[model samples]
Target: MRTFVAGQEAVDETEFVELALGIDVDLFRGPLEKETAEERRARRDVAREVLRELRESAEAGDEVAGWDALYADALMRTVPFVRAARGQRAGTGVAA
Candidate 1:
């Protein structure tokens, strides 16, 4: 993973490492096995919907705006897969 990230020359590597480490694993885990029905519904938020659109845009080669939205918030920004296209734009460069 580091090697892939090292291919980019524009980033401050430490920040990526930090964000990677800071990412909440649950975000990638989807619904937990023990989650109550209400808890599951609560996780279905506008933010997740917005993130979904950004993910689609990224997949579609719409890079700039997509990266900005994904990288704009702490919640979505730390997603591991996002690093694959992190430098697609300078992004917000702000950690939530």
Candidate 2:
């Protein structure tokens, strides 16, 4: 697989090279950075608000119209995670 370094220009996936003999490579994906306390609180707040909305919608028999809102809420919860994973995958590099 191709190698990368943080802050470098992006490269096409087809251009990745297989590792050579004796090379050391580490692969990491997902959230590589830690969230600050304030960010953590914000995420929790969003989650709680979404769950509350979902419960209210369920109680109101509004399931049909609730999915879109729930999906949007889910996206709000995960977009940062997806972005972080992409950044980590693109930024991590071989040390060999």
What is the lDDT, from 0 to 100, of the residue 33 in candidate 2?
Answer: 59
lDDT of 1 by residue, 7-94 (tens): 5432456556535443233443332334444664565464576567767877888876465445545543343444435442223345
After superposition of all CA atoms, the RMSD between model 2 and the true structure is 16.4
1-96 in candidate 2: lDDT tens per residue?
A: 546544333364322321221111111111335654476567556656655766587678877436535554454444355556555333255622
Q: Of the candidates shown, which would achieve the greatest lDDT relative to the real structure?
A: 1
Structural similarity to truth (TM-score) of each candidate: 0.30, 0.34
Give me candidate 2's TM-score against the actual structure: 0.34
- Candidate 1 local distance difference test against the native: 0.48
Q: After the best TM-score superposition of candidate 2, give how far the Cα of residue 37 lies from its true spot, in angstroms.
A: 2.5
